[model samples]
Target: MAERKHDRKFVRTFFTTPTAVEGEEDSAKMLRGAVGLRGMKAPDVWVPDNEDATAPSMRDEGAENIVEVVAENGADFPGEIHPRVVWHRDSPATRYQGFKHMLQISDPERGAIEHIDGFVIPEVGDIDDWKKADEFITIVENEHGLEEGSIAMSVIIESGQAELAMGQLREEMGKPTNNLERLFLLVDGEVDYTKDMRAITPTGALPPWPELRHNTSRGASAAGLIAVDGPYDDIRDVEGYHERMTDNQAKGMLGIWSLTPGQVVEANQSPLPPENGSWLLDVGGRKVELESEDGVEIYDGNRLSLEETGDGYVLRVGGDGRELDEDELREELLDMTEYVPSMDDIVDSMEEFEAAKEAGRGAIAITQSATLRIDGVEIDVNKDRMWDEATYQAAMTPITLFQDVYRNRPDQHEELAEMYSEDVVERAMDVGA
Candidate 1:
């Protein structure tokens, strides 16, 4: 993939705050508050939303507020600021309104253009619709005397045509008329997408369209852009939100639309490697993690048990017991055991492999074992994982993510230091250099 236009390597959270807040005396109160955030509360990409979040009657005032507030606070803010402008593939007036806002915000005389990173065009349709948005941004840059591709354009995949257009982005990038290379993020808008699909759920809640998320991630990977999941409306359900992030992370989508600052902190920290390693046991095809007590691995679950017998001991797995010798027990445990390495463990393994690579070794196998005592019987379990050049390169992802967070978010430095210590953090910064 070609190098992307933007310099942002980590966009773990995309926070959208309404530019205008109703019932508040100061219409720009929310925008001011979002812009003034610092430390862990600040999002990776701060969006001053002027579309769905703001009422139609107040959108004009909201646009002005975005320019004013962003100009004042954008310098101190540590994240990229991309304001969401109003646009629909079917509505010309809305597209024009969005165009006018971009012109207003991108004008150098307004004092906000220097602080603005880009504009997010929502409700985009086919490739032509995307090109229209790109053309608008290009015109704004030329009209403002800015660099040709200095301003980035991110789109929300809300319609079926937009979803299909993602597949055609690579071929379309070769064209010279519009600056399609300025595309930065491909964010999911499941609410609108569901409406577009006419999908219905008994609970009336939005369906979890896992296929759409996978396609978005795949498209972003193919086109070299960032993929972000849609918003989780239940802000209070933190566990559910974490589960969503976990699922998205598995699909290579690290970013999510955060509706609040509290959610921003969660999303920002979700993609990093765990501070400690863990062990997992397969219990009837489901993986169950064992707990640690004073550095000893313990499994108190009822899935596996040990019974005394005259010969030796009977191992019961899922209520099925059979007499087994020591060797059989070891083999059984080994087959069911899985080792999940921590950040420290991965670093140590990578460092060892790097030294081996220096010695001209192509691959190496590492062993991880644990001893668990259940019902007065002790059994040892070990699993071997191989590390090659490809494995080492893949393991470097979390380290690179840590480096990006360390570089872009200085406000999060203190927390990172506490998680992995100053020494580890310093070493991680220098890794893959």
Candidate 2:
């Protein structure tokens, strides 16, 4: 017995010719010879729907080995194709379900389709038109659990109405959900020269030309994932495409894709970095370092110092050592300063000099005799009377004078008033001539 060939051969090709029968036969013959099926069992051929008619004998001769048949263009077959062929249909329900089946069967890695997936064409004009689209999105989220930033969806912008409604669509889809991530914009329709003409070259002599303007209007939050699909004939003529993309990136756009591989390459090359640390504030010139009693030193780059004031720590800046009147600090200070007594009230209790004399306090005498006058004097007085009345009056006289001066003519004695109490003034007045 001859040994069978062990080598396995595979052929891959696409059928684009108009004659489907010839294409299928050619594909089958190519595979049969490559797989060594001349004398033994013949190899099977797999042809897409367009080329299926060529293999008339395949149904009887090679049906058993034929693994799968894919229908390329789904437009012709409504329900004839396999239930598994994930159709890109216009019906939202079917498309959403088909997307889920594709995910399950494809068993793609998590986040694999996040950067590339499907598109969503939002309803234009009245918001009521969007009710169906929103409901469809909710179904995708609740039933499929797709998650934002995990899949891409594009919106078709074909009409003037769609352009006007772009803002509303962005706002509605800007939130986090397990439906999809990103939005790709598709601009369709022709430029109307009569309505959209603009003067060119700025020469004022040249005739005006129609200007084509299409935009990917994105939400402030969704700017990062915003993109525009294109194969536009006049895209190269657009003055601000690159600038718009740059601005979009500044507003947090990840990148832009115009559908084709070339566009994808260009967009991916200029993608914003995944994580930007640009917002970290620099405090080199404005910072201050403080050492606490616990030996814990803190370098406050913002110049905010926390120090114990009364009940809590007060915030102060280092330069002028000025305490900040933060709301909390003010509240704490208000609590602390309540019911505090002044220095004058504390010192007014002193009554008599004889009492000080009894307590062995020495009196200071003037070096030279000074002209002094006594008022309301009754010189003849008993020791007890002198001690009780005269000594008390002498001790308190200075205090009384000081209070009178402070109340009557305080402008001249502002400094003295600040430093010394009323009792000190009264004593000085009594001793003076």
Candidate 3:
């Protein structure tokens, strides 16, 4: 069989920093220098200073690629320039100050989907509050007409609650919206197992084992979450770091942030191969022998021969096996492969997965479960489903899961909007309209 090819997409990093009028030219020079070093053009530049003078100055200095200007505390800028630049107000206490800023300009109708960053704010509190935060997110989504996969929500998981609520956070943020597309759980700051217990135990329960110091909380439910220790920490040599990240991908997280250039290069280079192998097929309780060109063959009582069909291969089973439907037989064969695991591969995969899982647990523990109700479902730390390797990978890469969810449960979009407040709704409308 020919090897399957996987294409990796590179995400551009938008750097954010405060600029001063005196240092405007120097700032532009530094930015251009940084751009040169990163081997890319600047996507957007955030001028934190609220003064109107700096915006025009930066614009005049050949920083024409600057897409938006962000200010803290809702400070307004001069109205002389293009209305394309958006203004956003955010609390300094939240971890997503930069994300909220970029989201203001993220309008799918305008074809403005770009990767951006938000400064990580260190805030401490109950991890359960992420549910309410999810509610706040819904408000933002409703107001802005944000839809799932429209704009990515990258939360800096600095607190215990932030880390604990990652799963639920992703789920809530991932609700279908007009503009939203991806949700990223970024574990920023120092990876302190003691202080940030939310990463260790997302559910608000005592440690599963007494020996485990960290208890679980509500925030750790979403699978798309990824944890990088911190900007200051050494990026190259963290324990179980790659597995923790891959585990997040397994859960549904697409990407992580705050990584240095070297770290980013390493992550993009990791190998992920498809699980492939041969398996025995039992069709309608009848067995058959299928042979591969590679000389690998499994035999059952029923005789099966492969005949070349136009543009495809067909299996003639049971000799007189009533001319099988081609589509049905193909489906059955695919299903059979999943059930029959290659013992050698499974053993090797499990060994690596176990080591990574233990390291992930040591660095950050996840608690997850699920419940179904006719009226509505309630998900939290205690009520959530724990993520095994497979589930973790699925949650981390939400593009895949989002497609699945939209196909499976199209009606859940409205429920997602109801979680937000009026302010968010108004903001969403202002931008989208």
Candidate with best TM-score: 1
Count of clashing pairs, candidate 3: 65
lDDT of residue 153 for candidate 2 = 36
Instruction: State the displacement of the C-alpha of residue 222, model 2, in Å, after optimal TM-score superposition.
Output: 7.7
Which lDDT tens digits does candidate 2 get at residues 254-288? 33323222332334323311111111111323322
The lDDT per prediction is 0.89, 0.31, 0.33
lDDT of 1 at 307: 68
Q: Highest lDDT, which number?
A: 1
lDDT of 3 at 336: 36
Q: How high a TM-score does candidate 1 get?
A: 0.96
| TM-scores of the candidates in the order shown | 0.96, 0.27, 0.34
Model 1 spans > 4 angstroms off:
1-3, 308-310
Off by over 4 Å in 3: 1-24, 28-128, 131-149, 167-182, 186-188, 191-232, 235-259, 271-433
Which 10-residue window of candidate 1 scores lowest in summed lDDT?
1-10
Clashing pairs in 1: none
Candidate 3 — worst ten consecutive residues by lDDT sum?
Answer: 372-381
